[model samples]
Target: MLFPIFLLASVAAAATGVIFKPGAWYDGLRKPGFTPPKWAFPVAWTIIYLLSAAAATRVAGLPGAGAALALWAAQIALNTLWTPVFFGARRMALGMAIITTLLVTVAAMTVSFWSLDRVAGAMLLPYLAWLCVASGLNWRIWRDNPAVPRPAA
Candidate 1:
């Protein structure tokens, strides 16, 4: 029972990227230096999601899982929204702003989860680290490609 719940969380997170068709937009971009290989993202995210699910499961049994879950949901919504903002809408600058918000929220979630379950909080560390790198990348991408047109509404 617990395993499935965790899997659902993992699947939900995994599906967010796919729902936005991240690959197609990602492939179209002129990535900045140090952009990890295309393959790296899936692998990294898969591991990250699995760890997150584990953490979530741990937290689920605790008292604050409700709040933790709410925070997690909010972060995931922001996470999913970024792909379309950056890729679909071609608004890297705005996407950067959105991702920044996501990062802060995730950090809050991490702290909250830590209060409930230390291991769960620890699981989110890598996610926060990745977002830090991604935020920097988003800023650079927007800066370098200032001339790129924002996709029409």
Candidate 2:
């Protein structure tokens, strides 16, 4: 029950990536050398979504899970917002801001989840690691491409 709900939320968040794809604008960005290859995004995201959903499902019915669940929702909402802000609007700085906030939120979520279920907490480790990589990438793109113009309304 909870697993499906969490998976649905992840799928919805992933839909944004499909909608605001990285086409010419992203291709033109001066990304860091550490940027993962183009093929890695979806593959990594697939694993991430599964792991995060599992973690949330594990913690969902436990005692004192309300705040942890809220953190999970916050992180997911932040995750959903990043794609459109970065790819659709071409607002790297704002995207960077979102990702940074997401990173913090996930960190807090990870800790909260850990307190509820150690395995669930451990499940978020990969997500935290990925967020680190993502945050660095977002920061680098914003820093390296100083003159990127936002898309017109």
Candidate 3:
């Protein structure tokens, strides 16, 4: 019951990537040398989404789950916002800010979930690791691309 709902929410958040897309703007950015290959993005995100849903499902009905679930919702909302800000609006700095906030929120959520269910908290470890990579990538892009090309009027 709860798994489907959580999965649906995760899928909806993931949908932002499809809608905004990297397209040419992202391709033109001065990516860090360590940037993951283009194919890795979707694959990694797929796994993250599945893990996030599972983690949420594991903790949803447990005692004292409210604050942790709130963090989950907040992180997902931030996740949904980052795609459009970075890909659609081409704002690297703002994207970095949002991702940083997401990282903190997820970390807090992980610790909270850990208190309720260790496995659920453990499931979020990969997500936290991925977010660190993503945050570094965003920071590098923002630092490297100072004079970003403005979208054509």
Which candidate number maximizes TM-score?
2
Candidate 3: Cα lDDT at 117: 96
**Which regions of candidate 3 are displaced past 4 Å?**
none
Deviation from native of the Cα of residue 50 in model 3, angstroms: 0.6
Residue-level lDDT tens digits of model 3 in 1-153 = 899998998899999999998888788888988999999999999999999999999999998999999999999999999998888888888899999999999999999999999999999999999999999999998999999875664
Q: Sorted by TM-score, highest first, which candidate order results?
A: 2, 3, 1
Task: Give per-residue lDDT, candidate 1, residue 75.
Answer: 86
What is the TM-score of candidate 2?
Answer: 0.98
Ranking by lDDT: 2, 3, 1
Q: Write the per-residue lDDT of candidate 1 for residues 1-153, one digit (tens) a residue.
A: 475776685677677667666555556666688777778888888877788777877888777479888888788778768877777777888898999999999999999999998888999999998888888888878777777766566
lDDT of 2 by residue, 46-92 (tens): 99999999999999999999999999999999999999999999898
Better of 1 and 2 by lDDT: 2
Instruction: Provide TM-scores for the models.
Output: 0.85, 0.98, 0.97
In model 2, which residue pairs have backbone atoms overlapping below 3 Å?
none
